[model samples]
Target: MLNGKVVAITGGFGQLGVAVVQGALAAGAKVAALDRAPAPAAASNLGDALALGGLDLAEPDVAARALDEVARKFGGLDALVNIAGTFRWEELEQGSVDTWDLLYRVNLRSAVSTSRAALPHLTRRGGGSIVNIGAGAAAARAAAGMGAYTASKAGVAKLTEALAAEVKDRGITVNAILPSTIDTPANRADMPKADFSRWVAPKSIADTILFLLSDSARDITGALIPVSGRV
Candidate 1:
């Protein structure tokens, strides 16, 4: 259903980010993958699609140029998925206030930068979709050491809701997917003894993003859909 469409993903080289890129390819869309650091060799699977590295998406001008590059390459952009973010396990009790600022830039500012940049291209296409990666932790009562991460993601949820309303008449749909403990290699390494089976799979999250970007979900804007699986 995504044939001929162009979709861009930020944080597009990470565990879940790669999954979303592969998912978009499977749906026949052209994908642009951007990251704050260079993608590993594994990302060669993207095979000539747009891939940018070391971009500070926290900077609005850089973010805008990235999207402009996509449009220049693809003629137009159809979807944008804000997946660039960071996770810090720090608590108010002993964690440094510096973590709060770092999380704000990596999580909240990244989304704000990308979404603002993509808005014009999406609008130029006559209509499109924007998906933000929100944490389930942001919705529930945050865990003890999750304040920084949760607060930033809460900002993402609010961005999705407010942007959806702002673009209601412009045919753009903004939504966020909230996932609980995505089962990445990094997460597994950190929680070696945890029940991996209960965590959401990257593919599942990618599938949810596909649904939101597809025509089937045209009416599903301003929603924060959770993809916890059995978690």
Candidate 2:
């Protein structure tokens, strides 16, 4: 569905990020996988997708340089998936104020920086899509100990709407996927007793993101689609 299009994914070394990269490549897109972690040897499994590691996407200059590199390498950029976010479960009273700051930078600011950097390239190509990974819990309601995380993700949801409206006239569409309890290794390790089957799979979310990037979803913008699986 993404034939010959260039797609860049942030947090590309993580489980979910890898799934998105593989899906996009399978759909005939050239992908640039950017992550804060060093490129793992297993990155070879991504076929020919470009792997750019050790990136601090929250920094505007860093994001700009990384995205500019992707555009230069791929001739231009068509879509971007902002999946570089961190989560922390902490009640406001028990958690340090630093936790809130950290989550805000990692979860919300990174998307803002990266999307801003990708705008020129996408506009130059006449149109593009941006898919942000938001938390379903955040969008619906925040539970106890989820203040910082939910607040950060809520910022992402708002960013999706504001950016979508800002770029609508430029043929750019921005949307977000709100997933509940993604079935990742980290989540499984963190909640061993939880019902894993109820959680959404990384591949499932990746497929949804690809659909948003495809022409089929060209008219869909500022949408916060919920992908909660059985959860």
Candidate 3:
């Protein structure tokens, strides 16, 4: 369904990002993987995917540069998936200003910067899609020490809604996906005793992202879809 399209994914080297990059490529879309980390050892599995170094999302200029580079390399840009983010598990008392700033920079500011940078590209293409990854914890009350993380995600959700309204008439769609607890390798290693089966899989999330980026989702905008696997 994504044939001939070019998709840009931030944090494209991480677990979920890997799934998205591979998935997009398999679906016949030109994939641009953007991440602060370098590309992993190339495997025969990735066909024609391209990896690009991305800057800290909080840096406005970096966002613009990344988008420009994508447009130049791919001839045009079709979709942007803001999968870059930071997570911290700290109590309210233990949370320092630096921690709050760092998380906000990665989780919230990155999406804002990326969306703004990709807007003109999407407009020029006549229409496109932006998918922001969010956390479900933002919908519930604080969990004693997740105040800052929760607040950052709340900002993401609100930003998605506001941006959707701003770009709806321009043929662009903005939406956020709230996943409860993703079953990533890091999460599995961190919580060995947890039920891995209950956690949402990275490929599953990527599937949803692919759907939203496809032409079939042209009418779906401003929606905060939940990808929590029965949690």
Top model number, TM-score = 2
Q: List the residue pairs that clash in candidate 2.
A: none
User: Number of clashes in every candidate structure?
Assistant: 0, 0, 0
Best to worst by lDDT, what's the order?
Answer: 2, 1, 3
TM-score of 3: 0.96
- Worst-scoring 10-residue span by lDDT in model 1: 39-48
What's the distance in Å from true for residue 178, model 2? Answer: 0.3
Error of 3 at 182 (Å): 0.8
Q: Return the number of clashes found in candidate 2.
A: 0
Which stretches of model 1 miss by more than 4 angstroms? none
Please give, for residues 149-230, the per-residue lDDT of candidate 3 as tens digits. 9999999999999999999998999989999899988998999999999999999999999999999999999899999996
Write one digit per residue (lDDT tens) for candidate 2, span 113-219.
99999999999999999999988988766789998999999999999999999999999999999999999989999999999999999999999999999999999
Please rank every candidate by TM-score, starting with the best.
Answer: 2, 1, 3
User: By lDDT, who's the top model here?
Assistant: 2
The segments of candidate 3 whose C-alpha lies over 4 angstroms from its true place after superposition are: 44-46
Q: Candidate 1 has what TM-score?
A: 0.97
Model 2: residues with Cα > 4 Å off, grouped in runs: none
